[model samples]
Target: MTSTHRPDLPQLMIDEAVRAALLEDWGRAGDITSQATLPAAARASAVIAARKPGVLAGAGFAESAFRLTDASLQFEPIMRDGDRLSPGDVVARIEGPARALLSAERVALNFLGHLSGIATATSSFADLIAHTKADIVCTRKTTPGLRAFEKYAVKCGGGANHRFGLDDAILIKDNHIAVAGGVVPAIEAAKAFAGHLVKIEVEVDTLDQLKEALTAGPDVVMLDNMQPDQLAQAVEIAGGKVLLEASGGIELDTVRAVAESGVDLISSGWITHSAPVLDLGLDIEIA
Candidate 1:
Protein backbone atom coordinates (compact mmCIF):
# COMPACT_ATOMS: atom_id res chain seq x y z
CA MET A 1 0.00 0.00 0.00
CA THR A 2 1.58 3.27 -1.23
CA SER A 3 4.92 1.47 -1.31
CA THR A 4 4.52 0.37 2.32
CA HIS A 5 4.05 3.93 3.54
CA ARG A 6 1.61 4.28 6.41
CA PRO A 7 -1.65 6.10 5.74
CA ASP A 8 -1.37 9.71 6.88
CA LEU A 9 -4.29 10.46 9.18
CA PRO A 10 -5.25 13.83 10.65
CA GLN A 11 -4.72 13.60 14.41
CA LEU A 12 -7.30 16.24 15.28
CA MET A 13 -10.00 14.45 13.28
CA ILE A 14 -9.09 11.15 14.84
CA ASP A 15 -9.21 12.60 18.35
CA GLU A 16 -12.51 14.36 17.72
CA ALA A 17 -14.06 11.19 16.30
CA VAL A 18 -12.86 9.09 19.22
CA ARG A 19 -14.25 11.62 21.70
CA ALA A 20 -17.61 11.64 19.94
CA ALA A 21 -17.77 7.85 19.96
CA LEU A 22 -16.82 7.74 23.64
CA LEU A 23 -19.49 10.26 24.47
CA GLU A 24 -22.10 8.29 22.55
CA ASP A 25 -21.21 5.08 24.34
CA TRP A 26 -20.79 6.54 27.81
CA GLY A 27 -23.84 8.82 27.88
CA ARG A 28 -24.71 10.54 31.21
CA ALA A 29 -24.27 7.37 33.28
CA GLY A 30 -20.61 6.97 32.24
CA ASP A 31 -20.05 3.22 32.23
CA ILE A 32 -21.95 2.59 35.43
CA THR A 33 -21.28 -1.13 35.20
CA SER A 34 -17.50 -0.68 35.15
CA GLN A 35 -17.63 1.80 38.03
CA ALA A 36 -19.71 -0.55 40.16
CA THR A 37 -17.61 -3.67 39.57
CA LEU A 38 -14.09 -2.22 39.63
CA PRO A 39 -12.39 -0.55 42.58
CA ALA A 40 -11.39 3.08 42.18
CA ALA A 41 -7.72 2.14 42.29
CA ALA A 42 -7.99 -1.09 40.29
CA ARG A 43 -5.66 -1.36 37.26
CA ALA A 44 -5.11 -3.85 34.44
CA SER A 45 -3.07 -4.65 31.35
CA ALA A 46 -4.74 -5.72 28.13
CA VAL A 47 -3.84 -6.72 24.56
CA ILE A 48 -5.90 -6.25 21.42
CA ALA A 49 -5.56 -9.51 19.49
CA ALA A 50 -6.85 -10.34 16.02
CA ARG A 51 -9.21 -13.28 15.78
CA LYS A 52 -9.04 -13.35 11.95
CA PRO A 53 -6.52 -12.52 9.23
CA GLY A 54 -6.71 -8.99 7.77
CA VAL A 55 -4.83 -5.74 7.14
CA LEU A 56 -4.61 -3.26 10.01
CA ALA A 57 -5.94 0.34 10.04
CA GLY A 58 -7.20 2.80 12.66
CA ALA A 59 -4.79 1.73 15.42
CA GLY A 60 -4.28 5.41 16.18
CA PHE A 61 -7.97 5.97 16.76
CA ALA A 62 -8.09 3.01 19.16
CA GLU A 63 -5.25 4.51 21.17
CA SER A 64 -6.98 7.88 21.15
CA ALA A 65 -10.10 6.35 22.66
CA PHE A 66 -8.19 4.94 25.62
CA ARG A 67 -6.26 8.16 26.21
CA LEU A 68 -9.47 10.18 26.00
CA THR A 69 -11.19 7.87 28.48
CA ASP A 70 -8.38 8.40 31.03
CA ALA A 71 -5.36 10.60 30.47
CA SER A 72 -3.24 8.15 32.45
CA LEU A 73 -4.04 5.25 30.12
CA GLN A 74 -1.05 4.14 28.08
CA PHE A 75 -1.57 2.37 24.75
CA GLU A 76 1.18 1.03 22.48
CA PRO A 77 0.61 -0.03 18.88
CA ILE A 78 2.83 -2.92 17.80
CA MET A 79 1.43 -3.00 14.26
CA ARG A 80 1.09 0.18 12.18
CA ASP A 81 -1.64 0.91 9.67
CA GLY A 82 -1.52 -1.12 6.40
CA ASP A 83 0.39 -3.97 8.02
CA ARG A 84 -0.70 -7.49 7.16
CA LEU A 85 -2.15 -9.32 10.17
CA SER A 86 -2.71 -12.96 10.97
CA PRO A 87 -4.92 -14.75 13.45
CA GLY A 88 -3.85 -14.32 17.10
CA ASP A 89 -1.60 -11.39 16.27
CA VAL A 90 -1.22 -8.77 18.99
CA VAL A 91 -2.00 -5.44 17.36
CA ALA A 92 -1.60 -3.32 20.45
CA ARG A 93 -1.27 -3.35 24.22
CA ILE A 94 -2.82 -1.16 26.89
CA GLU A 95 -2.35 -0.51 30.57
CA GLY A 96 -4.66 1.67 32.58
CA PRO A 97 -7.23 2.06 35.32
CA ALA A 98 -9.60 -0.91 35.15
CA ARG A 99 -12.71 1.23 34.85
CA ALA A 100 -11.33 3.29 31.99
CA LEU A 101 -10.08 0.24 30.13
CA LEU A 102 -13.44 -1.44 30.30
CA SER A 103 -15.27 1.79 29.56
CA ALA A 104 -13.25 2.51 26.41
CA GLU A 105 -13.19 -1.05 25.06
CA ARG A 106 -16.21 -0.99 22.76
CA VAL A 107 -15.56 2.36 21.10
CA ALA A 108 -11.92 1.49 20.48
CA LEU A 109 -12.67 -1.95 19.02
CA ASN A 110 -15.46 -0.53 16.87
CA PHE A 111 -13.02 1.74 15.02
CA LEU A 112 -10.32 -0.89 14.85
CA GLY A 113 -12.65 -3.54 13.51
CA HIS A 114 -14.52 -1.40 11.00
CA LEU A 115 -11.47 0.28 9.51
CA SER A 116 -9.53 -2.95 9.38
CA GLY A 117 -12.40 -4.52 7.49
CA ILE A 118 -12.25 -1.77 4.88
CA ALA A 119 -8.51 -2.22 4.49
CA THR A 120 -8.85 -6.00 4.17
CA ALA A 121 -11.64 -5.78 1.64
CA THR A 122 -9.77 -3.28 -0.49
CA SER A 123 -6.64 -5.38 -0.30
CA SER A 124 -8.49 -8.37 -1.69
CA PHE A 125 -9.27 -6.38 -4.85
CA ALA A 126 -5.84 -4.77 -5.04
CA ASP A 127 -4.06 -8.10 -4.64
CA LEU A 128 -6.03 -9.73 -7.44
CA ILE A 129 -5.19 -6.98 -9.93
CA ALA A 130 -1.54 -6.61 -8.90
CA HIS A 131 -0.24 -7.94 -12.22
CA THR A 132 -2.16 -5.37 -14.25
CA LYS A 133 -1.85 -1.60 -14.71
CA ALA A 134 -5.35 -1.09 -13.34
CA ASP A 135 -5.74 0.62 -9.97
CA ILE A 136 -8.54 -0.20 -7.54
CA VAL A 137 -10.58 2.72 -6.23
CA CYS A 138 -13.30 3.22 -3.64
CA THR A 139 -16.65 4.98 -4.27
CA ARG A 140 -18.73 7.47 -2.24
CA LYS A 141 -20.88 4.74 -0.73
CA THR A 142 -19.32 5.00 2.74
CA THR A 143 -20.50 5.19 6.32
CA PRO A 144 -22.13 8.63 6.69
CA GLY A 145 -19.99 10.01 9.51
CA LEU A 146 -16.91 7.85 8.89
CA ARG A 147 -16.18 8.68 5.25
CA ALA A 148 -12.71 10.04 5.92
CA PHE A 149 -11.69 7.09 8.03
CA GLU A 150 -13.11 4.65 5.49
CA LYS A 151 -11.37 6.35 2.57
CA TYR A 152 -8.09 6.37 4.48
CA ALA A 153 -8.49 2.65 4.97
CA VAL A 154 -8.93 2.27 1.20
CA LYS A 155 -5.55 3.96 0.63
CA CYS A 156 -3.97 1.78 3.27
CA GLY A 157 -5.22 -1.25 1.31
CA GLY A 158 -3.46 -0.18 -1.91
CA GLY A 159 -6.58 1.41 -3.40
CA ALA A 160 -6.85 4.99 -4.64
CA ASN A 161 -9.51 7.44 -3.45
CA HIS A 162 -12.05 8.81 -5.91
CA ARG A 163 -13.03 12.50 -5.58
CA PHE A 164 -13.68 13.14 -1.89
CA GLY A 165 -17.04 14.71 -2.79
CA LEU A 166 -19.05 16.08 -5.72
CA ASP A 167 -17.30 19.45 -5.35
CA ASP A 168 -13.85 18.13 -6.21
CA ALA A 169 -14.59 16.89 -9.76
CA ILE A 170 -17.22 16.97 -12.47
CA LEU A 171 -18.81 13.55 -13.08
CA ILE A 172 -21.76 13.54 -15.49
CA LYS A 173 -23.80 10.49 -14.57
CA ASP A 174 -26.75 9.04 -16.52
CA ASN A 175 -29.30 11.26 -14.81
CA HIS A 176 -27.15 14.32 -15.37
CA ILE A 177 -27.08 13.52 -19.10
CA ALA A 178 -30.86 13.00 -19.11
CA VAL A 179 -31.41 16.31 -17.34
CA ALA A 180 -29.02 18.18 -19.63
CA GLY A 181 -30.87 16.58 -22.61
CA GLY A 182 -27.85 14.57 -23.87
CA VAL A 183 -24.13 13.78 -23.39
CA VAL A 184 -22.99 16.74 -25.52
CA PRO A 185 -25.10 19.24 -23.60
CA ALA A 186 -23.99 17.84 -20.23
CA ILE A 187 -20.31 17.97 -21.20
CA GLU A 188 -20.69 21.42 -22.77
CA ALA A 189 -22.50 22.78 -19.70
CA ALA A 190 -19.92 21.31 -17.30
CA LYS A 191 -16.99 22.58 -19.39
CA ALA A 192 -18.55 26.06 -19.46
CA PHE A 193 -19.32 26.22 -15.72
CA ALA A 194 -16.50 24.18 -14.15
CA GLY A 195 -13.35 25.69 -12.68
CA HIS A 196 -10.12 25.40 -14.68
CA LEU A 197 -8.66 22.80 -12.30
CA VAL A 198 -11.69 20.51 -12.19
CA LYS A 199 -11.48 17.42 -14.42
CA ILE A 200 -14.69 16.24 -16.05
CA GLU A 201 -15.72 12.57 -16.37
CA VAL A 202 -18.79 11.13 -18.05
CA GLU A 203 -20.48 7.73 -17.73
CA VAL A 204 -21.64 5.88 -20.86
CA ASP A 205 -23.54 2.59 -21.07
CA THR A 206 -23.03 1.61 -24.70
CA LEU A 207 -20.44 1.93 -27.48
CA ASP A 208 -22.56 4.53 -29.30
CA GLN A 209 -22.74 6.61 -26.10
CA LEU A 210 -18.99 6.11 -25.67
CA LYS A 211 -18.48 7.42 -29.21
CA GLU A 212 -20.63 10.43 -28.44
CA ALA A 213 -18.90 11.02 -25.07
CA LEU A 214 -15.44 10.72 -26.68
CA THR A 215 -16.33 13.44 -29.19
CA ALA A 216 -17.38 15.68 -26.26
CA GLY A 217 -13.77 15.70 -24.90
CA PRO A 218 -14.20 14.63 -21.27
CA ASP A 219 -10.96 14.05 -19.34
CA VAL A 220 -12.16 10.56 -18.44
CA VAL A 221 -14.95 8.16 -19.43
CA MET A 222 -16.50 5.44 -17.31
CA LEU A 223 -17.74 2.24 -19.01
CA ASP A 224 -20.59 1.23 -16.75
CA ASN A 225 -21.25 -2.55 -16.42
CA MET A 226 -19.58 -3.36 -19.75
CA GLN A 227 -18.54 -6.96 -20.38
CA PRO A 228 -14.87 -7.85 -20.93
CA ASP A 229 -15.16 -7.90 -24.75
CA GLN A 230 -17.04 -4.62 -24.75
CA LEU A 231 -14.44 -3.11 -22.43
CA ALA A 232 -11.65 -4.28 -24.75
CA GLN A 233 -13.52 -2.69 -27.67
CA ALA A 234 -13.94 0.52 -25.65
CA VAL A 235 -10.23 0.46 -24.86
CA GLU A 236 -9.49 0.24 -28.59
CA ILE A 237 -12.04 3.00 -29.21
CA ALA A 238 -10.42 5.33 -26.68
CA GLY A 239 -6.98 4.40 -28.10
CA GLY A 240 -5.12 6.15 -25.28
CA LYS A 241 -6.99 9.42 -25.75
CA VAL A 242 -8.59 9.48 -22.27
CA LEU A 243 -8.58 7.63 -18.94
CA LEU A 244 -11.01 4.70 -18.77
CA GLU A 245 -12.81 3.44 -15.66
CA ALA A 246 -14.88 0.26 -15.24
CA SER A 247 -17.54 0.14 -12.55
CA GLY A 248 -20.62 -1.88 -11.50
CA GLY A 249 -21.11 -5.34 -9.97
CA ILE A 250 -17.38 -5.69 -9.40
CA GLU A 251 -16.59 -8.51 -6.99
CA LEU A 252 -13.46 -10.39 -5.95
CA ASP A 253 -13.80 -13.10 -8.60
CA THR A 254 -14.67 -10.76 -11.50
CA VAL A 255 -12.33 -7.84 -10.69
CA ARG A 256 -9.23 -9.43 -12.23
CA ALA A 257 -11.00 -9.88 -15.57
CA VAL A 258 -12.25 -6.31 -15.44
CA ALA A 259 -8.77 -5.02 -14.69
CA GLU A 260 -7.14 -7.16 -17.37
CA SER A 261 -9.53 -5.63 -19.91
CA GLY A 262 -7.15 -2.60 -19.96
CA VAL A 263 -9.12 -0.12 -17.89
CA ASP A 264 -7.23 2.51 -15.90
CA LEU A 265 -9.31 2.23 -12.72
CA ILE A 266 -11.93 -0.08 -11.24
CA SER A 267 -14.30 1.53 -8.73
CA SER A 268 -16.48 -0.37 -6.30
CA GLY A 269 -18.68 0.52 -3.34
CA TRP A 270 -18.72 -2.94 -1.72
CA ILE A 271 -15.25 -2.60 -0.23
CA THR A 272 -16.41 0.14 2.13
CA HIS A 273 -20.14 -0.41 2.62
CA SER A 274 -20.47 -4.19 2.65
CA ALA A 275 -17.19 -5.38 4.17
CA PRO A 276 -17.68 -7.36 7.35
CA VAL A 277 -15.85 -6.09 10.41
CA LEU A 278 -12.55 -7.85 11.13
CA ASP A 279 -13.06 -9.68 14.40
CA LEU A 280 -10.84 -8.39 17.20
CA GLY A 281 -10.99 -8.65 20.96
CA LEU A 282 -9.21 -6.90 23.83
CA ASP A 283 -8.47 -9.34 26.66
CA ILE A 284 -7.05 -8.51 30.08
CA GLU A 285 -3.42 -9.55 30.29
CA ILE A 286 -3.06 -8.91 34.02
CA ALA A 287 -5.09 -7.48 36.87
Candidate 2:
Protein backbone atom coordinates (compact mmCIF):
# COMPACT_ATOMS: atom_id res chain seq x y z
CA MET A 1 0.00 0.00 0.00
CA THR A 2 1.15 3.51 -0.77
CA SER A 3 1.78 5.67 2.26
CA THR A 4 0.33 9.18 2.29
CA HIS A 5 2.61 11.97 3.54
CA ARG A 6 0.96 14.79 5.42
CA PRO A 7 2.71 18.13 5.83
CA ASP A 8 4.77 18.45 9.03
CA LEU A 9 3.57 21.93 10.05
CA PRO A 10 1.81 20.50 13.09
CA GLN A 11 4.86 18.58 14.25
CA LEU A 12 7.08 21.65 13.89
CA MET A 13 4.70 23.81 15.94
CA ILE A 14 4.48 21.13 18.63
CA ASP A 15 8.27 20.96 18.84
CA GLU A 16 8.49 24.72 19.37
CA ALA A 17 5.75 24.69 21.99
CA VAL A 18 7.36 21.82 23.86
CA ARG A 19 10.75 23.53 23.85
CA ALA A 20 9.17 26.71 25.18
CA ALA A 21 7.45 24.74 27.92
CA LEU A 22 10.73 23.14 28.90
CA LEU A 23 12.37 26.54 29.11
CA GLU A 24 9.48 27.79 31.23
CA ASP A 25 9.97 24.92 33.62
CA TRP A 26 13.74 25.40 33.76
CA GLY A 27 13.76 29.22 34.05
CA ARG A 28 17.08 31.08 33.85
CA ALA A 29 18.63 29.20 36.80
CA GLY A 30 18.33 25.69 35.21
CA ASP A 31 18.02 22.37 37.11
CA ILE A 32 19.44 22.92 40.60
CA THR A 33 20.46 19.29 41.16
CA SER A 34 22.17 18.96 37.81
CA GLN A 35 23.89 22.29 38.28
CA ALA A 36 25.23 21.53 41.76
CA THR A 37 25.68 17.73 41.88
CA LEU A 38 27.22 17.15 38.47
CA PRO A 39 30.45 18.80 37.34
CA ALA A 40 30.14 21.27 34.46
CA ALA A 41 32.21 18.95 32.25
CA ALA A 42 30.29 15.79 33.25
CA ARG A 43 29.06 13.68 30.30
CA ALA A 44 26.41 10.94 30.37
CA SER A 45 24.57 8.49 28.11
CA ALA A 46 21.00 7.24 28.37
CA VAL A 47 18.20 5.35 26.65
CA ILE A 48 14.55 6.24 26.26
CA ALA A 49 12.53 3.08 26.81
CA ALA A 50 8.86 2.22 26.74
CA ARG A 51 7.57 0.61 29.93
CA LYS A 52 4.45 -0.78 28.23
CA PRO A 53 3.36 -1.88 24.80
CA GLY A 54 2.38 0.99 22.52
CA VAL A 55 2.72 2.52 19.07
CA LEU A 56 5.69 4.91 19.02
CA ALA A 57 5.55 8.47 17.69
CA GLY A 58 7.31 11.84 18.08
CA ALA A 59 10.86 10.48 18.05
CA GLY A 60 11.81 13.44 15.90
CA PHE A 61 10.37 15.96 18.33
CA ALA A 62 11.95 14.15 21.23
CA GLU A 63 15.33 14.40 19.54
CA SER A 64 14.69 18.05 18.84
CA ALA A 65 14.07 18.66 22.55
CA PHE A 66 17.61 17.58 23.46
CA ARG A 67 19.16 19.41 20.51
CA LEU A 68 17.28 22.62 21.27
CA THR A 69 18.55 22.47 24.86
CA ASP A 70 22.18 21.86 23.79
CA ALA A 71 23.19 21.56 20.14
CA SER A 72 26.23 19.46 21.05
CA LEU A 73 24.03 16.59 22.27
CA GLN A 74 23.85 13.49 20.07
CA PHE A 75 20.76 11.29 19.59
CA GLU A 76 20.78 7.84 18.03
CA PRO A 77 17.32 6.54 17.12
CA ILE A 78 16.56 2.85 17.67
CA MET A 79 13.06 3.19 16.27
CA ARG A 80 11.43 5.67 13.94
CA ASP A 81 8.06 7.32 14.33
CA GLY A 82 5.07 4.95 13.89
CA ASP A 83 6.98 1.86 15.06
CA ARG A 84 5.06 -0.53 17.33
CA LEU A 85 7.04 -1.23 20.47
CA SER A 86 6.67 -3.64 23.37
CA PRO A 87 7.69 -3.17 26.98
CA GLY A 88 11.43 -2.51 27.51
CA ASP A 89 11.98 -1.47 23.90
CA VAL A 90 14.51 1.30 23.63
CA VAL A 91 13.36 3.98 21.21
CA ALA A 92 16.42 6.19 21.25
CA ARG A 93 19.90 6.47 22.79
CA ILE A 94 21.36 9.83 23.72
CA GLU A 95 24.71 11.10 24.94
CA GLY A 96 25.35 14.60 26.18
CA PRO A 97 26.38 16.74 29.13
CA ALA A 98 24.63 15.68 32.34
CA ARG A 99 22.91 19.04 32.73
CA ALA A 100 21.56 19.00 29.16
CA LEU A 101 20.26 15.42 29.44
CA LEU A 102 18.63 16.05 32.83
CA SER A 103 17.05 19.30 31.69
CA ALA A 104 15.57 17.90 28.45
CA GLU A 105 14.39 14.55 29.86
CA ARG A 106 10.83 15.43 30.87
CA VAL A 107 10.05 17.49 27.81
CA ALA A 108 11.13 14.73 25.43
CA LEU A 109 9.29 12.01 27.33
CA ASN A 110 6.11 14.11 27.46
CA PHE A 111 5.83 14.32 23.67
CA LEU A 112 6.61 10.63 23.14
CA GLY A 113 4.25 9.42 25.84
CA HIS A 114 1.32 11.58 24.77
CA LEU A 115 1.64 10.93 21.05
CA SER A 116 2.25 7.20 21.56
CA GLY A 117 -0.93 6.96 23.61
CA ILE A 118 -2.99 8.38 20.79
CA ALA A 119 -1.31 6.12 18.26
CA THR A 120 -1.80 3.05 20.46
CA ALA A 121 -5.48 3.74 20.96
CA THR A 122 -6.06 4.33 17.29
CA SER A 123 -4.12 1.17 16.41
CA SER A 124 -6.28 -0.94 18.73
CA PHE A 125 -9.42 0.13 16.92
CA ALA A 126 -7.79 -0.30 13.54
CA ASP A 127 -6.66 -3.80 14.55
CA LEU A 128 -10.19 -4.74 15.62
CA ILE A 129 -11.52 -4.25 12.10
CA ALA A 130 -8.60 -5.78 10.21
CA HIS A 131 -10.84 -8.23 8.40
CA THR A 132 -13.36 -5.62 7.29
CA LYS A 133 -13.26 -3.04 4.54
CA ALA A 134 -14.36 -0.17 6.74
CA ASP A 135 -11.71 2.37 7.72
CA ILE A 136 -11.10 3.53 11.30
CA VAL A 137 -10.94 7.32 11.57
CA CYS A 138 -10.53 9.96 14.30
CA THR A 139 -12.77 12.99 14.81
CA ARG A 140 -11.92 16.66 15.39
CA LYS A 141 -12.07 15.86 19.11
CA THR A 142 -8.35 16.49 19.56
CA THR A 143 -6.07 18.23 22.00
CA PRO A 144 -6.06 22.00 21.51
CA GLY A 145 -2.89 23.10 19.60
CA LEU A 146 -2.02 19.43 19.11
CA ARG A 147 -4.49 18.48 16.40
CA ALA A 148 -1.98 17.98 13.60
CA PHE A 149 0.39 15.91 15.73
CA GLU A 150 -2.44 13.84 17.19
CA LYS A 151 -3.98 13.25 13.77
CA TYR A 152 -0.59 12.26 12.40
CA ALA A 153 -0.25 9.82 15.28
CA VAL A 154 -3.65 8.37 14.36
CA LYS A 155 -2.50 7.85 10.80
CA CYS A 156 0.70 6.26 12.04
CA GLY A 157 -1.44 3.76 13.94
CA GLY A 158 -3.20 2.70 10.72
CA GLY A 159 -6.30 4.85 11.15
CA ALA A 160 -7.48 7.37 8.57
CA ASN A 161 -8.35 11.01 9.32
CA HIS A 162 -11.72 12.67 8.87
CA ARG A 163 -11.96 16.25 7.67
CA PHE A 164 -9.15 18.29 9.28
CA GLY A 165 -11.40 21.24 9.99
CA LEU A 166 -14.59 23.07 8.95
CA ASP A 167 -12.89 24.09 5.72
CA ASP A 168 -12.07 20.64 4.34
CA ALA A 169 -15.61 19.39 3.87
CA ILE A 170 -19.22 20.41 4.39
CA LEU A 171 -20.57 18.30 7.25
CA ILE A 172 -24.19 19.19 7.94
CA LYS A 173 -25.05 18.02 11.43
CA ASP A 174 -28.11 18.17 13.73
CA ASN A 175 -27.82 21.92 14.23
CA HIS A 176 -27.61 22.42 10.49
CA ILE A 177 -30.65 20.14 10.20
CA ALA A 178 -32.56 22.48 12.48
CA VAL A 179 -31.39 25.58 10.64
CA ALA A 180 -32.30 24.18 7.23
CA GLY A 181 -35.57 22.77 8.61
CA GLY A 182 -34.87 19.10 7.67
CA VAL A 183 -32.37 16.65 6.27
CA VAL A 184 -33.33 17.14 2.64
CA PRO A 185 -33.29 20.92 2.76
CA ALA A 186 -30.04 20.98 4.73
CA ILE A 187 -28.32 18.71 2.21
CA GLU A 188 -29.71 20.62 -0.74
CA ALA A 189 -28.65 24.00 0.60
CA ALA A 190 -25.20 22.66 1.41
CA LYS A 191 -24.78 21.18 -2.06
CA ALA A 192 -25.91 24.40 -3.69
CA PHE A 193 -23.59 26.57 -1.65
CA ALA A 194 -20.53 24.29 -1.70
CA GLY A 195 -18.07 24.63 -4.55
CA HIS A 196 -17.83 21.77 -7.04
CA LEU A 197 -14.52 20.77 -5.44
CA VAL A 198 -16.02 20.14 -2.00
CA LYS A 199 -17.94 17.05 -0.86
CA ILE A 200 -21.02 17.25 1.37
CA GLU A 201 -21.85 14.82 4.17
CA VAL A 202 -25.02 14.94 6.26
CA GLU A 203 -25.64 13.49 9.71
CA VAL A 204 -28.97 11.76 10.39
CA ASP A 205 -30.12 10.28 13.70
CA THR A 206 -32.80 7.91 12.45
CA LEU A 207 -33.69 5.66 9.57
CA ASP A 208 -36.42 8.03 8.48
CA GLN A 209 -33.88 10.85 8.16
CA LEU A 210 -31.54 8.37 6.47
CA LYS A 211 -34.13 7.86 3.74
CA GLU A 212 -34.53 11.60 3.34
CA ALA A 213 -30.76 12.16 3.23
CA LEU A 214 -30.42 9.51 0.53
CA THR A 215 -33.16 11.05 -1.57
CA ALA A 216 -31.22 14.33 -1.50
CA GLY A 217 -28.04 12.49 -2.71
CA PRO A 218 -25.45 13.44 -0.11
CA ASP A 219 -21.87 12.22 -0.71
CA VAL A 220 -21.82 10.59 2.71
CA VAL A 221 -24.27 9.93 5.56
CA MET A 222 -23.35 9.66 9.21
CA LEU A 223 -25.45 7.22 11.25
CA ASP A 224 -25.19 8.62 14.74
CA ASN A 225 -25.61 6.31 17.77
CA MET A 226 -27.48 3.69 15.72
CA GLN A 227 -27.35 0.09 16.90
CA PRO A 228 -25.42 -2.55 14.99
CA ASP A 229 -28.65 -4.13 13.70
CA GLN A 230 -29.96 -0.73 12.74
CA LEU A 231 -26.70 0.07 11.02
CA ALA A 232 -26.82 -3.20 9.09
CA GLN A 233 -30.32 -2.29 7.95
CA ALA A 234 -29.17 1.21 7.10
CA VAL A 235 -26.35 -0.21 5.01
CA GLU A 236 -28.87 -2.29 3.14
CA ILE A 237 -31.08 0.74 2.64
CA ALA A 238 -28.18 2.80 1.43
CA GLY A 239 -27.42 0.06 -1.14
CA GLY A 240 -24.05 1.62 -2.00
CA LYS A 241 -25.65 4.86 -3.15
CA VAL A 242 -23.80 6.83 -0.47
CA LEU A 243 -20.86 6.23 1.85
CA LEU A 244 -22.16 5.24 5.29
CA GLU A 245 -20.33 6.36 8.45
CA ALA A 246 -21.01 4.82 11.88
CA SER A 247 -20.22 7.17 14.76
CA GLY A 248 -21.00 7.97 18.41
CA GLY A 249 -20.53 5.91 21.57
CA ILE A 250 -17.96 3.64 19.97
CA GLU A 251 -15.62 1.75 22.29
CA LEU A 252 -12.86 -0.73 21.47
CA ASP A 253 -14.97 -3.76 22.40
CA THR A 254 -17.85 -2.59 20.19
CA VAL A 255 -15.80 -1.40 17.22
CA ARG A 256 -15.37 -4.71 15.39
CA ALA A 257 -19.09 -5.41 15.58
CA VAL A 258 -19.82 -1.97 14.12
CA ALA A 259 -17.30 -2.54 11.33
CA GLU A 260 -18.97 -5.84 10.46
CA SER A 261 -22.18 -3.93 9.74
CA GLY A 262 -20.69 -2.91 6.36
CA VAL A 263 -20.41 0.82 6.96
CA ASP A 264 -17.74 2.52 4.89
CA LEU A 265 -16.16 4.34 7.86
CA ILE A 266 -16.15 4.17 11.65
CA SER A 267 -15.23 7.36 13.53
CA SER A 268 -14.33 7.45 17.23
CA GLY A 269 -13.82 10.54 19.35
CA TRP A 270 -12.32 8.79 22.39
CA ILE A 271 -9.05 7.92 20.66
CA THR A 272 -7.98 11.51 21.14
CA HIS A 273 -10.07 12.69 24.09
CA SER A 274 -9.54 9.79 26.50
CA ALA A 275 -6.51 7.69 25.57
CA PRO A 276 -4.08 7.33 28.46
CA VAL A 277 -0.48 8.36 27.98
CA LEU A 278 1.90 5.49 27.28
CA ASP A 279 4.61 4.85 29.87
CA LEU A 280 7.95 6.03 28.51
CA GLY A 281 10.95 7.23 30.47
CA LEU A 282 14.44 8.53 29.83
CA ASP A 283 17.01 6.98 32.15
CA ILE A 284 20.45 8.54 32.28
CA GLU A 285 23.42 6.25 32.91
CA ILE A 286 25.53 7.59 35.78
CA ALA A 287 29.23 7.47 35.09
Best by lDDT: 1
Per-residue error (Å), model 2, residue 89: 0.7
On residues 159-179, what C-alpha lDDT tens digit does candidate 1 reach at each position? 989888889999999999999
The candidate that wins on TM-score is 1
- Deviating ranges (above 4 Å) for candidate 1: 1-4
User: Candidate 2's residue-wise lDDT over 1-287, tens digit each?
Assistant: 21456324355676687778788879888888889899999899999999999999888778888888899999999997778999999999999888898889988998889889998998899888989989888899998878888888888788888998999999999998998799998888998899998999999999999998999999999999999999999999999999999999999889989999999999998988898999999887666
- Report the Cα lDDT for candidate 1: 0.93
Q: What local distance difference test score does each model get?
A: 0.93, 0.89
TM-score of each: 0.97, 0.94
